[model samples]
Target: MNIRPIEINDYSRWFDLWQAYLAFYTVELSDEVTQKVWERLMNEDDKDLYGLVCEDEDHVIGFTHYFFHGTTWFDSSYCYLEDLFVEQSVRARGAGRALINGVKEQAQTHGAAKLYWHTDKQNETAQGLYNKVADLTDFIRYDIALKP
Candidate 1:
């Protein structure tokens, strides 16, 4: 599998993988949100948000979305990998890891201080891979919904 930055031509395949990714998490997002995300990923002017895709035989098999932001603890920006998904049928084929490594290379290129991501507690399948690729932090995440 080959990993590369997402391009304008990747939308259809990317969308299919994106919907699958959302379904895997049991989350429903509006079309508007999805469109906005696609736009952001495609926008060359948007330096903060970026995307990568893993292709096997000219087909997109996986994708990842990440961003860099300033943190109080670091002098350089921190890279946060927000989403990562690979085709269900192709798990363990290294597409997921390739996409992650692609992101890590980007983070390093941009002088990021660290790279991090979160996974559900019960997602042991994913955690198994995460455990090998990254350090598990003890910090717990909490959120408050602010309605518009």
Candidate 2:
């Protein structure tokens, strides 16, 4: 599998994968949200947000989205892996692992101090794969959304 940065012409194909990812989590994202995300990814001036797609011979089979931000605790920007998804049929074929490793490489290249992400507690399948590639941190996430 080839993992690479998403390109201008890849919008539709990338959206298909994006939809699949949302479905996997049973989340509904508005078209506005979708378009905004695409715009952010397409903007070359935005260094914080980054995206990658995993391709086999014919199609894009997986994708990973991550971003960098400043933190009080670290000198280098932390890379938060916001999203990662491989096609259902392609699971266990190393595309997921490749995507993650690719992100790790990018974090290093971008001078990121760390690369980290979280998964739902119920996602045992993903946890199984994640356990192999990364250490399980003791941190628990708490969200307090200020806006509707």
Among these predictions, the greatest TM-score belongs to 1
Off by over 4 Å in 1: none
Alpha carbon lDDT of each predicted model: 0.93, 0.91
Clashing residue pairs, backbone N/CA/C < 3 A, model 1: none
For the record, the alpha-carbon RMSD of candidate 1 to the native fold, in angstroms, is 0.8
All candidates' TM-scores?
0.97, 0.96
lDDT of 1 by residue, 60-148 (tens): 99999999999999789999999999999999978888888999999999999999999999899999899989999899999999988
Task: Give the root-mean-square deviation of each candidate in angstroms.
Answer: 0.8, 1.1
Per-residue lDDT over 1-148 for candidate 2, one digit per residue giving the tens place of the 0 to 100 score: 8989988788988899899999989999999999989898889985557899999995889889999888888887899999999989989999999999999999999898999999999999999989999999998888997986
